[model samples]
Target chain A: MHASDDGPHGHHHEHDHSELSDTALRVRALESVLVEKGYVEPDALDAIIETYETRIGPRNGARVVAKAWADPAFRDGLRRDATAAIASLGFGGRQGEHMVAVENTPEEHNLVVCTLCSCYPWPVLGLPPVWYKSAAYRSRAVIDPRGVLADFGVTLPEGTRLRVWDSTAEIRYLVLPMRPAGTEGWSEEALADLVTRDSMIGTGLARAPGGVAA
Target chain B: MKPLNAMTAALEPVAPLPRCAEEPVFREPWEASAFAMTVALHQRGLFTWSEWAECLGEAIRAAQAEGDPDLGDTYYRHWLLALETMVARKGVAGAALLAQRQAAWDRAAHATPHGQPILLENDPLFTRGA
Candidate 1:
């Protein structure tokens, strides 16, 4: 985070007021204008930011994956209709209105990309990271899933078929990574901890129970 | 690791995705603000996702035409443009009003001292008349 006083203008001694980057100034200006014009409410803006910042994130999706792994019935439900299954667990809205849960198995791996743009399952995974939205990832994921995975340092077994799902405006995807070994009889909370965001996105695998940080 | 083809190799050094513990989803505070503003406007029924998508698509295309490279950094910049364009097209706020407000903010931000909030009232040209 840039400190209040440290910025592009930090070296200048002639000015009394701090300088902000043009982009930052523009955003602040736009918000002020919108608030003053009554097009938006200041409180509402804060509420929305607060929601994404805290209440909604990959943690919500981790719990869903954990429940699916621990309970057969929930796993079936997810396979049948992921949107409702995920919503039933209280994580659905906005970008996640339509959902598909693709499972990763020893025989096949599932990867996701949005070739047209960065359409992602925000309800499940939170906002996409920089790389997921990069042109390299979007264009190359479908054409070269194995290579993309390799870039992420994930190497699949020989002959493991890879399926790449291109996210669209109508549908979003969440990869249900296979449960790791040695987690037998573990509580859902502990299981959820093993569900990394990358695993759920199919860029990496679920952390081994023993590999989890202490 | 399998060797990448020429195309993938040209786009080498793909930045690693930030781990959940490594960084926040939003890199900058303004990016979050821009994202929240768009979602808030959508929730208010000012526009639909499809509409937002179209506007964003157009913005991205325009940026690309000007050699944007379509890398990830400018994604939110396009998003903000889309939001502004959508708001203007919908008549929620006119272009002139937005421009005026932008100028006001620029002034206010400059007038604010370090560590102080940049309030619209601080804009040197600000008056309650409008």
Candidate 2:
């Protein structure tokens, strides 16, 4: 969760444009090479960006978070059988046949780390951040969840249970962040305001009043 | 080297095309919820490995009759959809809870000048009607 823990690779943005690695240089070079070869087209780049921003992202999660905040019975259903529960709300697809939601409580914390790869609930959370699927976070979280959380400014007290979910094969985990107080009469729009990408991934909790900065 | 994948490489021919399937459009929320629900159940040990397998197989068969089989990729896609579905079904946070968290993420993302931009990578088949 901590960017610093990403490695001592220096700030990614600090690298000089031309001093980039061979892979980076080659990628840039290929653009011109393709154009010279009559392979590059104008709309291709735009299409890539459009797909990621609109077709896949947190809008999916926004809907889920909204639903969770509105219907207590539905929330219970999700906690019980997420697949059936989700189907009840008229949502389903290829990777969504099996759904599960884990609760994060005051005495217990849930952090999801895919030890194998970035096997995230993308349909729900959208594409995982590049860092989450990186080996650095994967290797470190399971061995040192507290240390990792500390980097994210989330140091839990002693005796608190920290459950590290290693997405081994068939299972993946999503954190059901605790609902912050002071919003008893909030609407779904208001509730959706509190759901953060990080909270969904279990790195941080949603703040009620002095909410964390985006 | 072999010409780069049209999608990943620069020289290949990569353009979108429609599917031949005949079902309604596939919404990811349901899939995400299903993925989450499966993961949650497995995590809680509510069902055994065999039982879960059977449930998935049944779901797959039903989906297949509708149109696509969604083999191979469903293993992980189901998990993503399941999570979304679960969130929708459970109402885990209630209205205020959802809003509060959404703002928190937004704030955290914006707090840092170098935050990673959110991106969406839609499944090709999902773009097609069921």
Q: Per model, how much of the real contact set is kept?
A: 0.50, 0.00
Number of residue pairs clashing in candidate 1, backbone atoms closer than 3 angstroms, sequence gap of 3 or more or interchain: 0
User: Which ranges in model 2 have alpha carbons more than 4 Å from their true place?
Assistant: A1-51, A87-91, B1-130
Task: Write one digit per residue (lDDT tens) for candidate 2, span B1-130.
Answer: 1222332233113211111222222233333333333443444554554444444444444444566434333433433323323333444323344333334333433343344442111212222211
- Chain B fold agreement for model 1, TM-score: 0.81
Clashing pairs in 1: none
Off by over 4 Å in 1: A1-15, A212-214, B1-21
Instruction: Considering the two chains of model 1, state its CAPRI-style docking category.
Output: acceptable
Candidate 1 chain A minimal-lDDT segment of 10 residues: A1-10
Candidate 1 C-alpha lDDT tens digits along A1-214? 1234546866635356756777887687678777767878888888888888888888988999999999999999999999999999989999999999999889999998887778889999988877787666787797778777877768898989999998887889999998998889999999999998889889988888777421
